[model samples]
Target: TGLTPWLAWVRGQAPPRRDFNPCGAYRFVRHPVYLSFMGLVWFTPTMTLDQAVLTGVWTVYLFVGSWLKDRRLEHFIGEPYREYERRVPGYPLMLVGPLATKRT
Candidate 1:
């Protein structure tokens, strides 16, 4: 449901949406892509020393980048984003219940 709107927004054809997203995987966590990337980094069956180092660096970058992105969104969207922040966890570890629960 959201992919098209997101793609449109990314293309600069639309403004940042004022609506809150609490559906699908977004209901479980705010940053699913970052979580997926982290999972890929840590859950690999085999990793060389260099891969481990790279994973660590990427993990750090993800955390920092997500923080920066969140701040930017909050600044751009203001109260709506702040309310969403209160309702949704930014990290997967912070998830509290089933992924489909739409808690507004």
Candidate 2:
């Protein structure tokens, strides 16, 4: 809804193309959008096997998709995305601490 306009604005202002997928979960999860959405949904008090499975599926997809996108962005956007990733939490959880810290 409101995001469409904001996304358009961002796209307009984004740097010149350096080749990107523009399809991965990076913008939502690596960026603030999906992280905020997850926070809002986390406390919902409903649970069902089907809903749980669907959530799991989407979560897995987001993780895998983000990994691939990171590889591309690391080559394109370079160090900035890597640095931002370290500072900001991933969508579902804050992957912090020594174990989670990315190694070059």
Candidate 3:
């Protein structure tokens, strides 16, 4: 976790990591960061026109960004992340994305 896939890609290999495992919030959703941030973005008490516009934009951005991140993480993190994707959704609350596998 020293450098992200973006920064470490220049080195022509996966990041130098001993291991990768999903735990805690990751066990629930593949994109916990985006999920939590999306929640914060939509919780505005006063939904002014400009605020609503900004919130809408951020919502779209987060969805797209989370999808892209999934692809990127699969590429860099390899099979484990792919397995996780198969078992989870990008947004579990909305039941979004593919597979949505039932874990044993």
Candidate 4:
């Protein structure tokens, strides 16, 4: 969600702190916006051939991009991001019940 990254940005702007924010929308998933995009693309009532191809390509991109982003976050935020990864489910799993838990 917008608020998640915005909070991170705000934190980064402050002095003597480089913290990981696993709050709000991020409590459920690492990439809530991408999950939302997947839902919008896949849950359409009808899909043309072009739409289907686009959906397939975009889905692949989302997963691959998320993986790369995970690497980047781990490198940038280090242990905290890794610990957050251990706690939160990614993507589709986040949509399911009981998988999401709030962690400080």
The stretch of ten residues in a row with the least summed lDDT in candidate 3 is 95-104
Error of 2 at 48 (Å): 1.2
For candidate 2, write residues 1-104 as lDDT tens digits. Answer: 35665776788864344443333565434545544544444545896888777777766665666667667767777777677566444553546532133545
| Error at 102, model 1, angstroms | 18
TM-score of each: 0.70, 0.50, 0.74, 0.72
Worst 10 residues of 4 by lDDT: 95-104
lDDT of 3 at 31: 77
> Which regions of candidate 2 are displaced past 4 Å?
1-29, 40-42, 86-99
Better of 2 and 3 by TM-score: 3
lDDT-sorted candidate list, best first: 4, 1, 3, 2
Q: Candidate 1's C-alpha lDDT?
A: 0.76
The better candidate by TM-score, 1 or 3, is 3
In order of listing, the candidates' clash counts read 0, 0, 0, 0
TM-score of 1: 0.70
Rank ordering of all candidates by TM-score, starting from the highest: 3, 4, 1, 2
Task: Find the candidate with the highest TM-score and give its number.
Answer: 3
Q: Residue by residue across 7-103, what tens digits does model 3's lDDT show?
A: 7799777665756678899887877888788788799677899988999999888878876877788787898887777677667655534424424
Summarize candidate 1's per-residue lDDT along 12-89 as a digit string, tens digits: 787445565568887767788989999999999999999999999999898788778888887977877777777777
